[model samples]
Target: MLNHSAGIRPQTRQRVLDAITELGYRPNQAARALVTSRSQVIGVLVATRAAAYGVQKMVYEIEDAAGDAGYRVAIATCLSDDVSVRDAVDRLVAQAVEALVVVGPQAGVFNRLTAHPLAIPFVMVASDRHDDLSVSFDQVEGARIATRHLIELGHTRILHLAGPVGWVEADARMRGYLAELADHGLAPRPVIRCEWTADSGYRAACEVLGTTDVTAVFCSNDQTALGLLHALHESGRRVPQDVSVIGFDDVPDSAHYRPPLTTIRQDFAVAGQRAVGMLLAQLRAAPPPPADPVRPRLVVRDSTAPPG
Candidate 1:
């Protein structure tokens, strides 16, 4: 026993494997897989840049759910392209993944996807358009809330900064802003179109400055609002006191701004969990399934006040 200390312990599993191999027996593969009918792996395709916080939160929630269900997650990056998304799907399929959760798909994906038949079950995250197996935040209600807050503060000459015209989410928010204003018989204020960026917001803000009688602006997103804040400061316009600013998407750090931002909040994590649940039910062909549409709400803060 003392001399045996220099030797390695006998390898038992290898010996068993060797015996099985010699006997042409598929012990592990046959026994484990035959009973389970599952590969225990799930594929995830994140379809946006790595920097988006909302997308990151969704991924975390999906990961938590997969772990609890005894499933291993395999992640792939689509990085925003129809070709890349399809390619990512191919890659995941090659890994023997049983299902997929595709995140941050653009509204156009549904149209593109209709052309191809999916080999594995798929669940789309943050799709603005409604789908049988989807969960989305209430963009329209949130934007309406943002606009109403300004209107209540005596902002009659309010403007709307909209995101790209073609995207479904942007259009939804715009609709809310329009409806909120129309209810009060307020004439339509000029709307600025821009990308979802702080710099674009700054440019749009400058355009708003050229026109007189503007009392407030409802930005389509937090980043654009941040840029508007900078532009207003540089142009000697005070927020709330001169021109109130409201934004959508209550991202972290909005509260720490010089004049804390008031915006709408979307529960991305909840949406992600709900989307996966719906997808799973569909995958299993559950009978008499029920999937209630998820709705978006709003959060208000200190960004708007009565206009002088």
Candidate 2:
């Protein structure tokens, strides 16, 4: 009666439900799993350092979607090293998770995952469509949109403040920036590599201001852009006046920046929902659909304009 199996009379079912409520009985998920071989749990793997706003938003969305579908989510946080990733995977597998979702921005995490394939269905949340089980916001296209906006504003010498070298999103954004520049017949400038932090962005901006002559700059992420904006302000340069600046990941705080930054907005909710749906489908033995990268849109603000 509790399982709601068919063929029970309504009166008997009501009586059993009433009795259960009077007894305050709760179903034991562990005992049920033992009987039915269904853990009804989805595992999520994320890197500790990669827990940015976008990643956290996606994870929240995934959890909500899974709950709506009558499943629980088990999250495992790991460091950005091979050993940590392997251990995380082992931990989730030991939990009898029916499926897995990988949600870190590190390339090394994916490399380790590829080297050690899983026995169960899994989906990777990333910007690259490297496999059928991957879902992402198109990082490359987002960069292109940001760069093209600056180019159309008549800024010819645009500097790219790239993210850490081994990060996947950073590399994709850099590729997009370079590709857009090439399409406009502009020579690519040397990229300044920085960690995905405001401090790193601040230092990189200082370097750029000291050594390079540019009309604009594109940062790999919103935090990096925030640092750059601070550096430019301290250096007595005006945004979109002395130099235009743009960033990626239209984070919640980007709009609150001093200059209200222009940025690329990724649909993290859509990405999360699609990733969960894909994993569910895979678990049901359905054929995987073609992997399509989610497109990002640009949000214009006070930070970018025609180079003065």
The collision pairs in model 2 are none
**What shift in Å separates residue 90 of candidate 1 from its native position after superposition?**
1.3
- The per-model lDDT (C-alpha) reads 0.76, 0.90
| TM-score to native of every candidate shown | 0.82, 0.94
TM-score of 1: 0.82
Instruction: Summarize candidate 1's per-residue lDDT along 1-308 as a digit string, tens digits.
Output: 21235355468555755787798964353355457776767888877553456777888888887777766688888756679778887888877778888775356765555567787777776677566655666678888888888888788888888987666568888998999889988876767898888999999888768776888889998888899999999999898788888887778978877689988877877876776676567667864234444555556666678896
Q: Which ten-residue region of model 2 has the weakest summed lDDT? A: 127-136
- Candidate 2 on 158-231: residue-level lDDT in tens? 99999988788999999999999999999978999998899999998988687888999999999999999999
Superposed Cα deviation of residue 162, candidate 1 (Å): 1.2
